[model samples]
Target: MDDVDETPDSVLAARARTGDAAAFGALVVRHQPAAIRLATIVGGSLDDAADIVQEAFVKAYRALPQQRDLVSATPLDPEAVALATTDAQLLIAALARLGERDRQVIGFRYFAGLTEAETATALDAAAGTVKSRTARALARLRQELDRSGVRGD
Candidate 1:
């Protein structure tokens, strides 16, 4: 443990990657002050900066093994774009005829991209209710779209 502080960051990082607790602690101790300082310069307060730094550290630690993998910066898939463009226009037209709650359910399910549980939380209903309501909303939307003759172009 003597002169452990003299270890280079690269060595510490390597050790940390291998699950060396002491080495990771050393790396954190060495880098955290700078991270906090940078966060503070951007975030405008000590409390906020500390919170940001802590979250960054946690995320960084969790992602350490996958750091070398390249991530897609733009997540909008072309297939999704094509489908949404063709069907969404007709769907939007149908949505306009539904009641407010039905519209909200559809919006939460599709446009807002909320999961059933999340939609339930947003609507303050049970998850099962959200699922059933979503089914009913889709059926209503289908009838509305059929009656309006809003075919996907």
Candidate 2:
């Protein structure tokens, strides 16, 4: 990890796609904090969630691209991901603004501790779609929080 702090995720992901192990590792390092927070929310008991989410996710192949793109697409900070991690009220307020399906997807995956397969079953969609939808839902939530001026420390 050379100073990847300033590097855009797109470049890191492209390099990762080409099997540049260093670049792949760099990408992982850059996204680790945000991704870990995601896993906790979308996957177990707040205390038990980290292990469950960590076990369920390893590569994040499907998610990495969108997450990478989201970095450029939104003004939300990695720190905002931490906002929901810190404040229950802010998370709920943001969640309330999402459409029904988005809210359900997040609720099922995170609040209810439903597996992607289980959530897909609940949503009547395929497993892959669940993953994609969850990613989009989270991005939207973060965007909403940012737009609404929710600050987390």
Candidate 3:
């Protein structure tokens, strides 16, 4: 398509399924705001929402190649949704305890899998800044998890 922005989701999805990074990037850009909003509604804050959305997109990107089609005909099972909601709630709660900068660093480094240099570019900061922020964020997240009684074992 001349305008990838104007391309339909199904078309983009199909292209992405075939390993078209541009098509997937376009899809992510198109749906990110709404996805973030939905995630916020479920996760209870913007920081948690961003993490949830980023994680979901990352999962989807990994799984898309194995799918026979982009859209599913079957509806979601209530039991599965309920089961996932509990885990999601816990993650959201943990993420919510982090500061905005902590969340941003965690989201870029862990959830989005961006390198220090890439995250620095995205945040318009120096690579050293990204590295330090990521280290601090992880430490804080670990403390939060420990306080919440979530054993890493």
Candidate 4:
């Protein structure tokens, strides 16, 4: 595919899954900056942000099979919908600023579109705990964004 054809994340993901190291490298190149920024926002130092991003990508790769399985079971297209929505990018950036528990809660619930019960199962926490963490993480994100001059009103 031409460079112009490289924008689709699903394509990149599929390539990466087949042991295409170049595709996986491209994915890392595409997402690392945002991931590192997220790591830094989550209280990691600049030096450690790179490491955190590396780890996140590793985790993303490892979880890809399950994600594919889930996608196959559902008809909805998360990639298409996410590309069309501004909230997707905002949510990713916001996730970087959350603590580990808060991040996992948000990632599983919002990004993964899992129900509270499903999130609880994935997180090994009570459903109520997932709900509470989601609430607190969102509130904290709003507060942080406001402080960072992201909130307009």
Candidate 5:
């Protein structure tokens, strides 16, 4: 019989979930640069950007099973992926303009794929507070990106 085929992301994710540091390291090698580019666009410096990206990926990995569950429960479609990618980019750009607290909120909510409740838990803030902060931070980032002529996709 032929070996079962698996997509690279699925394989990597599985390996990562199983605590294979090397597999996770490979995943980082594959995706970290894109994450860093996004973080730099949001965090304003190479060092800060790298840090943010690293944090985001760590958070992403921690939340991956939940994210997959949510996705599976909903729908797996191109539109969803496209929307998520756009939102991620927008949030990254916005995070770059924010202070530490605001950045943490956005990173946890958007990149980490956390719900408001989950975000509140992680941040030790009220859900309402997380929601408001996310909204305000996003609005400010939108304004800043617009002023900078970085059109949102």
Candidate 6:
């Protein structure tokens, strides 16, 4: 296996976020099996799971931030991967607890990195409404994280 094949998923994702198509392709190749397994578990059909995984990856690619130099922003120590995985799991669980509207606003504003106006357009709401929803969603997400004993360090 080459260096890219041995690279961690978080590293690949970081590269993919920086507009590296090959890195994204590597990510898809590496994680496709697990993603398919997850889709199968949730969708209950292998055929449907493959379609769902494809769509999900497409959305994920679209949602990646346009500009972020995160890979070099923080040096990766041995514990970084474990910490990142734990934090991601915590955030995902917290998001799952949110109401649908709250989730949508958070996903659009943060996950998709859309401006309030853009989010407003996507949500069919006014910019002010999007702003309000984003604030409320953030508050709710904070509450969820706090309740889960996830501390920002």
What lDDT would each prediction earn against the true structure?
0.72, 0.68, 0.78, 0.68, 0.69, 0.78
Which pairs of residues clash in candidate 2, taking residues 3 or more apart in a chain or in different chains?
A: none
Residues 1-153 of candidate 5 have per-residue lDDT tens digits of 022233355666676666666666677877888877765554346897687678777776776555542213333578888977876666565556678776667767776578999989978889999999999877877787776556676
Global lDDT for candidate 2?
0.68
Ranking by lDDT: 6, 3, 1, 5, 2, 4
| lDDT accuracy of residue 42 in candidate 5 | 41
lDDT of 1 by residue, 1-153 (tens): 446789866677776776677877787788889666644443346796587677777776876776663333455677997977767556655676677678767766775457999989978999999999889988898898888665534
Q: Ten residues in a row with the worst lDDT in model 1?
A: 66-75
After superposition, the stretches of candidate 2 with alpha carbons farther than 4 Å from their true spots are 1-86, 151-153
Off by over 4 Å in 3: 1-63, 66-85
Find the candidate with the highest TM-score and give its number.
Answer: 6
Error of 4 at 48 (Å): 2.0
Q: After superposition, how far is residue 144 of candidate 4 from its true place, in Å?
A: 6.4
- Candidate 2 per-residue C-alpha lDDT over 16-90 given as tens digits, one digit per residue, 9 for 90 to 100: 655567776776666656555654444324554455445444445544454543324444577886765667656
Clashes of 5: 1
lDDT of 6 by residue, 72-95 (tens): 655678698798888877887787
- lDDT (tens digit, per residue) of candidate 3 on 1-153: 469877877778878999998898899999999779645543347897787688888898998877887455565677998867765665667777888778777776776667999989977999999999889888888888778766665
Is 5 or 6 the stronger prediction by TM-score?
6
Model 5, TM vs. native = 0.49
Better of 1 and 3 by TM-score: 3
